[model samples]
Target: MKNIQVKWWLLLLLIISTTVSSCEKEDSGNAGRLTETDFMVAAANSDLFEIQTGQIASGKGTLSEVREFAQHLVMDHTTSSNELRILANQKKITLPDSLTEDNRAIRMRLSGQSGVAFDKDFIEVQITAHDEAISLYEQATREIQDPDIRNFATKTLPILQGHRDHAVMVKSKIDSF
Candidate 1:
């Protein structure tokens, strides 16, 4: 009788432990990502890095301009990514660090092009990326609940819009070529 009671208690404890462990695993999995707004920011920032990297590798632009522009991209995106990561951590939200499939497709297309073709594609994607960024940031500026986050969105929107303008100008010229 005592052995039977001991066996049942052990089984109950094991089941409870397993249930707790699984719940912990699930919670941790959900904790590492960003909220929707931050996620979109990170996604756009990732594309910025991708474009900079592709441009640097292609070496298509005037060497000085290419290097300077690449520096700006890397610094800007790195700061954005880090900020989003911090926010995600605080919010206990998981963010996708890798580019989405569509972004990846664009990256692959850019990788395949050379010289003027690469420059045109790069500028074109920059316009689209910044357009999306501005739209999303504009929405988030109004919608986000956190004061700091809302401010971040609001503050970043104009810079993104400016980039979009520059991209549009460059793309127009490239299209002419």
Candidate 2:
């Protein structure tokens, strides 16, 4: 009788442990899914970086082409940022109001440059930033579950691609000089 009781207790404990383990796995799976909030936060950060750097480039760039490209970045990213803000407000997700620490550092570094050096560095920065933005938007389009956010990502990818191509062109021009 005692042996049977011990066996039954062990079985109950084993079942409980297995059930608990399964529950943990399910919870983790849900946590791993890409959400709109995550995409928005990252998008907001990217827009902020673009806008700030563009502002600097517009003022400090030696070349008219570089200044024009900077102006374009500021205009487009400002519009994108405003739209993101509206979406974030609707979803009750507070988007970041400023650049990330790394971006702030980049801004500081760019601020210290002037003339042709500034234009070259600014174009390089834009190329790298737009590349990152394109990747983020592409990933969001593929992995995000929210229809609105996925649509936004899909729509924005082309713009990011355009910016990257323009940046590459600007880099070539700067290199030729």
Candidate 3:
């Protein structure tokens, strides 16, 4: 009788342990992963910042090249933002809708400038923003476990590189003037 009681207790413990383990796994699902979620949020914020700053540059920049580049940024980032939003929705990720404090400060600073100064500042901001975005996307491509998010990062990287190259070229031209 005692042997049977001991066996039943062990079985009960085994069942309890299994149930707890399964619950823990379920609670920590894919959506809880920081790498994927962080990448989406950061990407969303980046797109918003680019679109707003590009709009400002398009109107305030004195140089045609700067205005044209700004227009491209506005268009491209707007498209990217929409795509990201769809992806985030599909993945059940909540993305930020507005700029971060740092981005807000940059936008404020850019908004206060005009003419040549505005052109130079805008180009400089573009270069820096593209560099950071490229880094984030590249990291996401490497570290993200979600196949869809990784694919998004992979697809967007080349476009970001192109933007960075264009920004550099524009900066050189601005410096020469």
Top TM-score prediction, candidate number: 2
- Model 2 lowest lDDT segment of ten: 30-39
Question: Each model's number of backbone clashes?
Answer: 6, 0, 0
Using lDDT as the yardstick, the better of models 1 and 2 is 2
Per-model TM values vs. the true structure: 0.65, 0.91, 0.81
Candidate 3 residue pairs that clash: none
TM-score of decoy 3? 0.81
Residue 61 accuracy (lDDT) in model 3 = 84
Off by over 4 Å in 3: 1-34
Residue 1 lDDT in model 1? 100
- Itemize residue pairs with steric clashes in candidate 2: none
| Cα lDDT tens digits for candidate 3, 27-48 | 8785444488899999999999
lDDT of 1 by residue, 1-177 (tens): 999999999999999999999999999976654456564556555545544554553365533333344455566666776776686677666767666677777777766766776676677666667777777777777666677677767766776776667566666666766
Q: Candidates' lDDT values, in order?
A: 0.65, 0.91, 0.92
